[model samples]
Structures are given as C-alpha cells and as structure tokens.
Target chain A: MSEKPTIEAYLKNIEEGHFKAYKCVDCGMIIAPPSGSCYGCGSSNMKWAEVSGKGKLVSFTVIHVAPDQFAEEAPYYVAIVELAEGTRVSARLLGFDPLKPEQVRLGINLKLDYEKGKSGATYLAFKPA
Target chain B: MPLNNTNIVSAAQTKFGALTGVTLREIFSEAVDKATIHAGIPKKDIQAAFIGSFIPEMLVHQGHTAPLLLDFAGLKGIPATRHEDACASGATALRAAIMAIESGLYDTVLVAGVEKMTSVSTSKVTEALAAAADDQFESSIGLTFPGVFAIAAVAHMQKYGTTEEDMALVAVKAHKNAATNPLAQFQKEITLEKAMTPRYVAWPLKLFDCSPISDGAAALVLTSNEKAKKYTDLPVKITGTGQASASMNLCDRSDLTSFSASVDASRQAYKMAGLKPKDMDFAVVHDCFTIAEIIASEDIGFFKPGEGAKAVRDGITALDGDKPINPMGGLKAVGHPVGATGVKQAVVIYRELIGDAGPNQVANHDTALMHNFGGTGATCVVNIMRRADL
Candidate 1:
C-alpha cells in the first residue's frame, strides 16, 4: 500500500532514492521493471514491494557508440543485475575503469544506485559492493 | 520440412550499396519487375503482395507502405500488407506469403523488402534504428545495437574464453566471401589485423566487426506447389519455416551466450523439415555483428554451445569447411538493409541451390538454412529450403 504498482510509481521511488520491485499479492512472487501481470501465475493482482537493492552481475557491456543523447557519455558500462528478490534489471555499472574489460567479472556482487544521464533522464545504476 | 506446396519460383535484388539517384519507389520497382519477368508471368498475374519495411514513415515520411509498394509493382489493390519487426521485417513479410499459400488464400504472392537509409544522416538513422530496442528500459539507458551486441560479445568472451581474434576471423571470412559476390556492398577483403585495429564502436567490437547500414531492395515470387512448375523449371521448396520471439530487453534474457529465439525457431524448422542441422548443406545466419554470427551458429544447433567461435577460428565454418557458412558473404559484407537483410539471405541460398552462384557455389549446397533475426534477439525466423531437383 506504499505506492501504486505502476512503472511511473516505481520510477518515482527510484528518483527519490529507493529501488522498488513488484510482488504478486496472490502468490508472493517478485519481478522487476514492473509488469502488468504476475509472471509466476499470470495474476493481475500486484503491489509495490521494496527490495534490498543488492544483486549479482549476470552479464554486462561497455557502450562506446551511444545514442544521440548519450554521445558524450560513450564508453559507459551497462549491466544486468539480479536482485536478492529473485528479479533482474538493466542498470549502469559504475566504480570501474571502462577500458579495462578484463578486470570485470561475472556473478560479482553489486549494490543498486540511481543517477541522472546526459539526456537529463534518471536511470538505475549499480556499484561493486 | 513439411510437404507443403509453397515454392520460390523467382527472386531478384538490387545491388546492395550506396546507390545514388534511386528513390525507394525505383529500387522496389526494379526488384519487382525483375522478379516478375524472371517468373515468366505478367505483373497482372500476381494475386497479393507483402512488404517488409522498417521505417518508411521515419525515413521517407510514408505510411501505409504496403499499398504504395504494391502500386509501384503494378498490383494496386491485391491485399498488400507491410510487416515491421526491426531487422526481421523481411522474414516476417515472407511469412505472410507462406501463410497465405498454406491456407489456400493466394496461389501467387510477391514477397519483398526495401530500405533507403543513406538519404538521412548517420545520427538520424541511428535514432531511427534504435526504435527496435526496448525504448523504455534498454534504449532509455543509452544502449545502441552495437552496444547491445557488444555486451553479448563480452559475455561470450568471459564465459567461454572467446578471444577477439576469433571474433575477427568471422569478419575475415565474411569479406573473403563478399569479394566473390558482385552485388555485395563491400567486395574488398581485409586481414585480421586490419579488422581488429579499427576504431572501436563498442568495447571489444571494432568498426569492421559490425554490419554496415545499407540501402537495397529484394523481391521473391512465390507460388503454390501446383503452380510452381508452370513458372520456373527450378523451384526451391520451402520445406520448413519457423519463427520465435524472446524478451524485448537484452538484460531480461537468462543467457547472453545464445539466443533462445534462434534455438526454438531452428528446432521447430528442423522438426518441420524432418532434418537436423547437420543435414543442412550450408547456412546464412544473422551476422549483424561478428559475435552474432558465432552465437547464431551455436543457437541454430550447427555447433556446440561454445564451439561457434572456435568453429570460425578452426576453419570449421569456412566456405569449404565441413559446415559451410555465409558463402554469400552474409550481412557482414553483403550489406544489411535492415528490413531487407533476412530476405536477401534467402535469395542468396536460393541462388546457391539453383546452381546460379557464378563461382561461390559449394560442392554440397543442396539443402540450406537461413536465419533472420530482429532486435536484440526478440524475433527470429529460421527457414529450411531444399533444391527442387533433390
């Protein structure tokens, strides 16, 4: 009952410095990037559920040729992080040299954060825990 | 490969490159006219049309392109539809014709794809093409197609020890094959050092590792089995057709090393054709990037999970190797017109099967496979075609 189970609501929370997830009210399942229906049982019943903001890196990329908005922010790392709530989200990876790709490891622990991009857009980001 | 009566009687394509003084209308009409003439049928004989177009609206300020393209082909009111699935739009449009024939809806159909990208600036084209990714999540975070595939490249390297050298080998092989294709965009071959030394588009992915943005058009004439023999002496039977989709976002996928869509589609296509990947004589997969070809080869069951990189490195996927791949140069060098790439892949294999591939012919290219992939592995279509004489 903290906030509506909408992506806008989820982003609002992230913008206000909190990483949120969606939990199925019926089956107690959790998912990220907010879905209209439950992935576990296809139930539309859902609510905003807070997560630990802790996860592990699954896969990642260092973007050199960015879109027009982020042209100045080339050579940034984007990663897929699995949360403790058993859901995954795409976020920017920070606190590591982008040129040294070999130093990055898979399945490493990361902590969630939020930042503003050159496009003046807020996005989810993460750092090595 | 099922025993259906759908066959490709004729196919044609405009040379893929920076074609000047040609409008989309001219490019599409040229391919249509050539295909119609080769089919030995008047344009009036065409019953329906399907077009694969990604961004006529964005690039040309055109919408409802199906009828417009149909009008250009002289088939104005015959139930035309334009399909859009990012890069897989060509195969998606091709599927409509196949379905129309399978359901007895139309005996003769025109399947075509066209894209004019060079007219716009490179930044405008980049913005337009980025529409294929997950706009809300992936693209919002500043990921381009090159960056998307770069992640896959790095993941493959980390998981299976795939080296950048192995990735460069794919580019080398692709250019070698393209040099033989007179219609290909980049007919000049490059060494591995040249390919590797180029400026990086994304980390671990150089400029040479990516498929070029091209302008081209291709058309195919399809007919029901009963009508195929009357049109052309050499008919390539579309024995198996399979399409599958995955998560829209790259991060949502459980595995980055392989695309589930390709695996599911190829498995279904193989099951329908009653043959396995090993039985295929050759293949043309979606090599949008060098790493993509490696992953696609593995995803299509042509090689083991991690062997795709090594396959290219060990000459296992060369033109004369045991499993020949991309003899028509693939998208790497043949040019990817985005919406037209998948259809061009089909046309290449079709030519190889009919013994019309001047000197690029393989010894055993009797049966072939073509993999058409859309954005970020979201949509994929795998097709198995066999020589009519077989």
Candidate 2:
C-alpha cells in the first residue's frame, strides 16, 4: 500500500497543476477529493494515482447568485465533470460565455485547468479540450 | 398490524414568511402553545422535548437551544435534544420524539422545528445553507442550494425532455394552492408568464423556482395510542416513518434526475404502513426548488421516472388532481423556514387528515405522506399518516 492521500495533499497537487485522485488498493477504483474509505469496495487502503485530468461535462449550471465568498465572481459556470477515470468532480467550467447557457452543450470534452479566485486562492477548473 | 402504536394528538405552526422581529424562542414558544392548547393537554404532561433548528447558532448566535426553547415554552427541566439535518431537521426531531414514545420511554413528548432566517442577509443565509453540502467537494466549488437543484433540473430536462415551462407550471400550481392557504407566504396565484419571467438564480432555475428564506416554527404533540384518547377525539395515527440518505455531494451520485433517498425512505414507510403510493390520498414533499418537486413526485412513486414533469403539466399533482401533492402550497409558496419545514409538512398533513384544513382542503384526505430532505437529497425523511379510526 502507498501513502494515503489527504485533501491537503490532493489540493496542493492541483495547485501545482498535477491533479490526482485516491485509488482503492483492493479494488483499483479511483476516488476523487480523497476519502477515508472507498465507496466501491469499502477499503481504507488507498494510494495516490494521477488522473489524466480529462473529462466530459455531465451537467452544468451558471451561478448568478453565489455565496458571499464568491459573490464578486457571480455569473460564473459550475459544472459536474465526469473524469475519464470514471469518477466525477465539481469544478468551474471556463472558456464559455456565462450569459449563453443555451450554447453550452453537455458531454463536451474538457481538460483540467485552474482558476485563481478573488480570495487569491487556487481552485480546480476545466475548459474545452 | 401496521406501525400505528404512536399518534399525533395535535400539530400547529406559525404563519411562515419573513416574520420580522420575532426571536427564535418567541416563535417556537408560540408554536408549542398552539399545539398544547389544541391538544387540550397540560404542559406538565409533556415528558420530553425534541427541537429542530438549523444554523441558529450562526443566524441567531444561539446554540444549546433545546433547553432554551423548551424553557421559554414553559416546559423547562425535561430532557431535550436538538436535531439537525439541514432542511430535514424538523422531521428528524419528530422521528426522535416518535421513537421515544414507541420505546416506552415517554407517553407524550413535544416536537418542534424553528428557524429565524430573515434576521440575516441573503448571502449569509446562503452561506449557512451551504454548510449542509460537502464543504470540501461541493460548497467550496461555489454550489448554492439552488445551484445544486439547477444541476438536477438540467439533467432531468436533458433526459426527460422536460422544458422550462413544465418546471414553471410547478410554481403555478404551488401558488394556486397557496392562494387559499391564509397562512401561506405567497397567497396569490401566478400566471405561467409571471413564473417564467423571473430572472435566473441558477441556469434553468428562475427566481421563482426556489423556496424563500423565511422565519417560522411548527410543533406537534405525540403520545402513545393508549394515551391519545385522553387528548383529542381525532388523533392522527402515524402509521409509517422512514429515513434514508445518499452521497452528500451531487458529483458522487450516479444520477441527478431522481433522489434515491426519497425512493428508499418512502419504500420503508410504505412497507411499515402496509400501504402503496396509490393508497396515499396526497403528499406534501420537500419542494425546496421547483425541480425538486418534480423529482420528488417521481421518486416517491407517485409517477414513473421522467413522468413527474408531465404530471405537473397535466395538473395531476394539483390540489384537486387525482393524487394531490402539496395541497397546502408546499415550501415553494408556503415559505421554507429550514428547520420548521419538516414539522410544518406534518402540521399540514395532520390538519388535512383530521379535516381541519380550511379552504385549502383536498377532497380525498384520508391518508397522506410527508417527505422532507436535507442538502440535495443527502438526508430524506418520509412519514405516512392516517385517521386513527382507519
């Protein structure tokens, strides 16, 4: 078994532009954002595995009313991206017109990217590949 | 025999809306007063208390609320506990109270849910509600409650050909039902054009699609069946109660079109009651968002998958429809006071079951179901109620 992946480490990797997920040592299933136990096999034995950072947009929403932290960045896109590793994660969908959701089609391929928020914090993001 | 050992002697709620200047303790005590008076039971008879209030510590700067609220209501010194499951907090408290009675621990207990949200700003309320979602995965990425349901609305629209108008129709029905409900927040019917005209809160979910942040509270007095006769002649038997959950994050879910927790919870309740969806005269589900109502209608077996939208369009879920849903305006028009909503759902159903619902009453109200969920379907509670004589 390899070292267990922590959210801090997973996020630090994303900040460094190297995205990774936790893979169950018993079932070889990829778990994103790190979990104590794998949902598939219920295994606590997991290791870090770098994902291809490529996925398709399963669903998306243009947030016009955001929480206070992201209030300045209203009218941004938040989407559920189905990673190529068969797991899904929520990330900002960049490179799209927020005002034109009619044109943003689902199932469109997207590659991993990052966006610096108003708080000067790095966030996981994606754009059209 | 069904699980009919426990009965609700009475239930009551404050008019849900932006109740300005009302403190948490005041509203909760008001609800408790109304319920105990209606039940014709002395406050001293209450053995314990289970209260539900979500985010009050943040919104009102008050925690350890169980005793505080109970003490204000003049029921001080009884064992009390606060239950929190985001929007489902009230129902979770009710479930706890019911179990306490069923376990032979208490003959009668008080169950109440309250939330004073209008005291805070909208953004602050939004941030507080976001706490219900997974902070690391969903909320940190900027997912508001409306955004969470908007994602589901988009997925359902894609797979079921459910148009935005169909979603708007739900708001229309909600407003229509609430028009006659004197206690409802939105008491006037809205045209389809009006419902669709509101600006987007999230893509595909307009301003009218989401439930409002309001201040209110609801209370119920539950007693064992043997002791129920001492209170009221029309006690409503709680035949079935079910609670289930799913992945907290929407991304972890395999499908967004329906909430599996509702399905599982309703199934458990139905089995316990020896009833089916068809047997339920109506349902008051958690319609925190318009799309959520559509999804819940199908999830609880009132309609097949992808059929809930059509049901709304056809007026099949209206107050006079074959299977009336949200006959008392629901959270959409009734105003969702977070913790109060779950208990309020039971309050509405209990009134309908006992023929106490005024102008908003449905023709067929012998049996009903109340479904309440917290945080994008992560926590769901369903309770089936029937007239005691039945």
Candidate 3:
C-alpha cells in the first residue's frame, strides 16, 4: 500500500513555483492536483512528476455575478484547460479582459500561471503561452 | 432497477411563484398535508418520510430539518430521512422513499422537497448554490451555474452550429407554456425577440435563458402496488428509476455538449421499464437553463446529439409537437426551487398525464418520463411513469 498524497502537498509544490502532478506508475496517466487512485489503471503506485505547464483552453465563462468572497473580482474569466498530459483542470484565465468574453477562443494554447486572490491565497490560472 | 409498482397515488405542490414571510417548515407542511389529504390517507398510514432541501440553512439559517418538517406535517415519529443532490435533491428524496417501499421496509412513504430561496439576496443565494460545484476548482474563482452552462452552450455552438437564436427559442417556448401554468413563476408570454434581447448573465446565456430563483415545495403520497389501489384507482405507476453520478467538474468529461450522467441514468431507467425513448408520449426535463433543455433533450435520447436545438427550432418540442417536453413550463418558467424542482416535476407529470394539468395539458398522455439533474450534470435521476391503465 502506498501512502496517499494530499492536495495540500500538491498546492504547496505550486506555492514553491513548481507545477507537479501525479503520474500512475502502471499506465502513465498524469493527474494534476492528484487523486487517491489512477483513473486509467486503478493503480495506487504513483509518482510525483513535474508537468510541462502547457495546455489549451477547452471552455470558459465570464462570471459577471461573483460570490461574496469574490465580489470585487466580479466579471472575472474562469475556464477549463486541457493540459498536454490529457488531464483537464479549471483555472482563472488571465491576460484578457473579463468583460469581453467574445474575444476568448476555445482550444487556444495556454501556459500554467498563478494568481493571488484577495485572501492572499494562490490560485491556478492560465495565460497565453 | 425496476420499481416494483411503487406508485404515487397523490401528488401536490404549492404555487411556485415568489412568496414571502413563510418559514421553510410551513411550506413543507402545506405540501405534505395537501398531498396526503388528496390521497385520502390518514397521517398514521405514512410509515416513513423522505425530504429534500438545498441551501435551506443558508437561506433561513435552519438545519436538521427532516424532523421539524415531518412533525409540522403531523408525521413526527415515523423514520424520516433527507436527500440533497444540488438541484436533484427532490427527486433523490422521492427515489429513496420509493426504494424503501420496494424493499419491503415500509408500505407507504411520504416524500417532500422544499427550498426557501427568496429570503436572501440573489448574490448570497448564488454563493450558496455555487456549493454544488467543485469549490477548489470552479466556484472558488467565481464560476456560477450560469457560467458553467454558458460554457457548455458555447461548446455546443462551436461544434454544432447552434446559434444564439436557437437557444432563445427555448425560452420563448417555456414562457409561452408557463403563461398557462397557474403555479408557474413567470406567467407571461415572451417573444423570441425579447428572449434574444434579455441582458446576459453569461455570454450566449441571458436572463431569459436562466431559470429564476424560486421558493416552493412539492410532496407526494406513495405506496406499494398492493396498497396503492386502496388509496386511489388512478395511481401513477413508477415503473423505472435510474440514478447515476459523474465528475463534478465538466473538464473531466469528454464531451461538453451533453451530460454523461443524464445519458447513463436514462439508460438505466429505460432498461428497467422495459421501454424505449420512442415510447414516451411526453416528458418533463431539467431545463434549468435554455441551453440545458436542448442538451437534456439529446442526452435523454429524445433527439440526436446536436439535433436537440434543431428539434427546438423545428417546433418538435412544442406543446403540439410529436414529442412534447416540459408541457408544464419546466424549470425555465415553472420556477426552479432547487430542492423542490425534482418532486415538482413528478407532481406535475402525475397530474398532467391523468388529464389534470387544467389548461396546460398536452395532447399525448400515455407514457411519460421525468428527469432531475444536479449541478452541471454531476448527478441525474430519471424515472419513467405510466398511467395505471397503461
């Protein structure tokens, strides 16, 4: 039995300015932000590896009405990015105006980035590579 | 699994428009009393209870609600349970009660779903509802329900050439039907131009496209097949029930145009009922947004993958169409009281199928299907019901 990795550790690595993902030792499936078991092979045997930090925008939405915590950040862009590893994750889309959603295109090449929120917590974001 | 003749003998719901000053428990009790009394069943006859609520605590600062609701409805001592699956909570509760009866654990069960959402500001309500999404991934960054579905709408448009005009047609149809539904939230008809011009909540998804923030309650009196005849001869037989869960994040899914949970759950439902989608005379789907209706139409196999929008455009889903969907105005106009939406669908279908939809009933009425969906298709509950004579 392998020791399960925590999300905290994965985020901590990101805090250290390194993008790390868990790859299934059995099937080579790369999962960002890690999981307890491999979706492809159900293998507990996993290893932490650095990601290429490259992805493409699959879908996105401009949240005009934000939550209370994100009120000042209203009209922000959030999108799902499909990474080079074939794993998808939701992150903030930077380097663009949130009010102008028509300008953003799907399948656009992007690179992994980070943004600090009002709470000073680091969040995953993507920008034009 | 096939429901073993667990039938809804009587179903009732309060008017689904905005109502103020009523506690959540009061709304629940009203629905339970109306349904059981209409079923001609004594309070003592209900052996168990199942309730569904979403963000009730956020709206009213109330929690541990099942007991209080059951007690208010005069069924305090019976074993009671609660179900929460985002917007599918109401149907989840009904499914649990049905299973309890089918498993021989109880002969009769009272199922209720209620949500009092109008009490708070829409911003706060939006925050509470965003809990349905993955906080770490989506909502934490301010992704609301409208945004998630809008992204799907955009994907559908990119792949299928579905236009904003096609989506607007869905809202037009919903409002046209809702104008006739006495209990609907929006009781006025809207033109295609109006739907198109409505302010945008998210790109490609406008105010007219989104289901309104509603507060309401719905309840059903269900009993086993053997005991059903004692309550009513016109019971709605729940022949099939299928529930499936999916990844909460839409990114995990391969396709953004359709909900895999809906496809999977409907497959299980069709298998259990010994029926096919073509056999459905009518259906009430989870049209939380205009684009959602189009996607749901295809996901449930009523239309082809991208043909759902075409079906909407061609008027194939209208009240007079070949396959009428959401004859009772659906969530778009009927009002989506998250927890209550699912059970309300059942109640409306049971009433409409038995020629009880008042002025809003469609022409077809033999076999019907009801779909309840939770958060971006993360969970879905699909059930096939038939009039007892059928």
Candidate 4:
C-alpha cells in the first residue's frame, strides 16, 4: 500500500482557496483543516467558521537547503502561525524574496495564500498581510 | 540474596563492539550456544524462546529473521516470537520470557536480542531510529533522536539549573565503567575536561554525550525456580518486571523534564518486587544520552527529580557510589545496539549478581535493576532482580 498524503497535502491546500476549517462553539477553539469534532471539548458541537484568512506569524525557520522533495523551494521559511481567533497553525510562509528571522516579526499580521503542488493537491500557505 | 521468583540460569553474549565478521543470525547462534553450555542444558530443555530485534530490514534487508535464527540455532520447534519496542526490544523480550515462566506458561524459556547495525550507514541508522519518534511533528521538523534529547537537556538546564559539567559527569562515569568491560565499545576512561569540550551534534549536547553505534547480540535462559534446579544450582530470579507507554508526540506533554513512562514502569516493578528504589544495591539505566541517565535516575525514584543532575556532579552515581548506575558502561560507552541493549544490560546484572562481573563488579552487590527506554522515553521497561531464591 502507498503512504497517505500528509505535509504534501497541507502545503498544496495553502496554494488553493478551498482551505476549510472549523471552530468549537463552546470553547471558541479553532480547528485547522476542519474536523468532525472539537479536539478541545471532545464535543460534536462545531460549526463552519470561515476564517478571515488572517493571522500573526509566531516563529519561523529558514531552510537554506531543503530536503529532496522540497529542493526546488530551497531557502523557504516554515512558520508557526497564531490565527486571529487565537489558534496556532503551521504553514509555509511566502512573499519574502529572501526569508530572515529579523524580517519575520512576532506579531506581524499574516494573510492566507493558496498554493498547489505537483501532486495536484491544493493547500494553504501564508504571506505578510 | 537469591532469585525471588523466575531465575536466569545461564547468560551469554557475542563479543560486543563493531561486529564486522558475523551476521545477526550467527551472533545469535553463538550466544545461544554459550548460554546453553554455561547452564549445562540441552537444546530440547528450553520450553519456549523469545527474540529481540529492531530495524533488521533497514540494516540487512531481512524480515522474519527471529524464528528462522532460532531454528538455525538448533531450537527448531520451540515456541519462539520476536519482540520490538525500539531500544527496549531486548529487555521487553526478556521480561516476556520471565512472565511466561512466572505465569506457568512454560517452565523454561530462551531470551535473545541481536542487532547488526554496522551494515547500515550512520545517516540511515539515524533516519531509521527517527521513525520511532512522532514522524508528523518531530521528524517533520528534522529532529533526530539526538535533537530530541538535546531539547530535553536544554529544558533540564533551564528548569533545574543543571550545568554542562553535570551532563559531562555522566559521560565520565560511563566511560570509566566501560574501561573495565571487555565487551564495551569505547573501553577507555575519559576525563571530565575532555567530555565538556563540546563538538555539537545538537545544541547543548556534545558528541560525548551520545552513546556509540554498535553491533552485538546477548542471550539468556530463564526458568521457574523448580525447573531452574535441573540446569544450574545458582540462578538469578526475576523479581519484578514492568513496562509503561506515553504520548508519542512531545507537543502533547505537559512537562518535558521527566518521562512519566519511566516513573510509572519503575513504580510498578518496585511495587511488584515489594521493594523501593532505596532498596536497590545498584542499577543499569538506559543512557542512550548522558542527559537521559540523569533524568531517568530521578524519575525512577533514585533521587529527587532535580537532584539527579546534582548527584552526578557529586560523583554519587559512580561504580563505587552508594547508588551506582550503569556499572557496565551503559549505552554511552558499552554501545546502543538497539534490540540488544536491554538484554545486554540484564546480562551485566546477572553476571554481577553471580560474582562474575569481573572488574566492573560493585562490592557486595545483592539487588539490582535494569531500565530500558525506547525512543525519547516514549516506552519504558524496568526489571528488578535479586540474588535470592523464591
């Protein structure tokens, strides 16, 4: 059997606009990539919460040399993001020609970007708002 | 002291280090031969068998090698099964054999652990081991086992004021013990000054803090007290065997300083043995990284949580100390051949209890424990033994 799509699908979703998510009604917990149930409250009480597609860049690491699968995108930044609703997420940060930690501010507003990979998977990416 | 319940009548191991001239199967055969000879028992006498192996396919492109190797070793039709739990594979297998005897499944069993790590490149080995971690989170971040342990070391220093010197002390003691162990990988003692000179594999963890990559095998024969008499007059009984598991992802943990798995497993073993950590004469802990030993000592109740680092600094865990740890050099110096490590640690304690540990023997040792941890403390098994009859 073949392996499941993981990081590949995630990145591809960022490249496309069809990125969907969910939020817990009771605890105000945001669920990235959407889920049938709330991971926080363990309740089935969830609703389709359309994100503003905006957040803050929490932290990032610039990979000078990427792995074989990501070699073409060498020198990219993988950042952990805190959404406007206070949920944290991880995604590839785009728009900066040359990524640097100093350039990536802690509270800088981030706008969502949709990206597509060679595998025909659409995913979510991020850029400075 | 004599064995408390199940006894280890005989123990043997391949010449550990970088095994260059033999395959895993051959190593197991030799170890089985030596163990049976030492116990003065025939192959037909072993009622059951357990084999421990990790990453055989990655190292040798072979799977389902355990039963086949047992058959090759002349135990053609015994109840044999393979055990896999990362570095704790061998120890867990031994614990299974002990439990089988204690539970009256079989009167006698054979336990063996083997790994042929030298056949693979260092990078491939690292990659294979990383699979034991949270592949989606940790490995995705390019965090190797050393890197995971490095984070723990940094957390220890940050939370408990553990210094680099404290970490180096563990390496120093492990090497000193290995200096006298013929089967140890780096059988030479190193000074604390040399250990502190860091060549970074990961931040806050130096090359010296890591255990050596090794290839080896170890085997032992286990039996009930009644049946043990048929083979040998002296047998080290398995007093207590315990195991525990935890969250695979570090991000899910509330605290990073101590492995809750080790704490629970050791507690179970101590309870089963009707003893406390304070009653132990000595121990052999999983020291895949120097920081791991320090943290594990505290988690297993040897010392107060934060005091283990201080204890190391004070020369309290040395072979001559009140509570010696890893007297057989540990994985740091003795080598971490994964599947073989847990069983090998048991062999060290069995020899010591039998007055056969040679130069590494602690003075007047009676009770001992072996801690085998799999992957950044995700899984753990603790076995307590004594030189007394049940």
What would you estimate as the lDDT of candidate 3?
Answer: 0.87
What stretches of model 4 exceed 4 Å from their correct place? A1-129, B1-4
Judge candidate 3 at residue B236 and give its lDDT. 89
lDDT per residue (tens digit) for residues B1-390 in model 2: 467678999899999999887799999999999999655789999999998888898899899999999989999999999999999999999999878988899999999999999998877888788889899877887878899999999999999999899989999999999999988988999999999985999998999898888999999999998999999898998989999999998898899898989999999999999999999999999999999999999999999999999999888999889999999899999999999999999999999999988988889989999999998899999999999987
Error of 1 at B230 (Å): 1.3
Which residues of candidate 1, in runs, are more than 4 Å off? Answer: none
| Better by TM-score, candidate 2 or 1 | 2
Between the candidate structures 3 and 4, which one is better when assessed by TM-score?
3
lDDT of 3 by residue, A1-110 (tens): 24455677777766666667888888989986567788898888788777889999998877776677877776778888999989988888899986677788888999
TM-score of chain A of each: 0.93, 0.93, 0.90, 0.71
- Candidate 2 stretches with Cα past 4 Å from truth are none
Give the alpha carbon lDDT tens digit for every residue of B1-390 in model 3. 556668889899988868887878888888888998765788889998989998788888988889988888889899887888999999999889878888898888888899999888987888888889987666765678999998899899988989889989999999989899888999999989899984778776888889999989999989988998898878888999999999888777888888999999999999999999999998899999989999999988999899999999889999989988898799999898899999999998899888898777879898899999998789999999998887
True lDDT of residue A102, candidate 4 = 39
Pairs in clash, predicted candidate 2:
none
User: How close is every model to the real structure, measured as TM-score?
Assistant: 0.98, 0.98, 0.96, 0.82
Provide DockQ values for all models, in the order shown.
0.73, 0.84, 0.67, 0.12
Best-to-worst order by DockQ is 2, 1, 3, 4
lDDT of 1 by residue, B1-390 (tens): 395788999988889988788988888888888789765878887899989989978776788888888887688978888999999999999988888998898899989999988888888889999999988778888878888888888889988999889989999999999999999999989999998995888878889899998899999989998889888888998999999999888767778889999999999899999999889989989999999999999999999999998889889888888888899798999998887887888898889899888878877878999999998989999999998778
Which window of ten consecutive residues has the lowest lDDT sum in model 1 chain B? B37-46
User: iRMSD (Å) of candidate 1?
Assistant: 1.2
The 10-residue segment of model 4 chain A with minimum total lDDT is: A1-10
| TM-score: the better of candidates 2 and 4 | 2
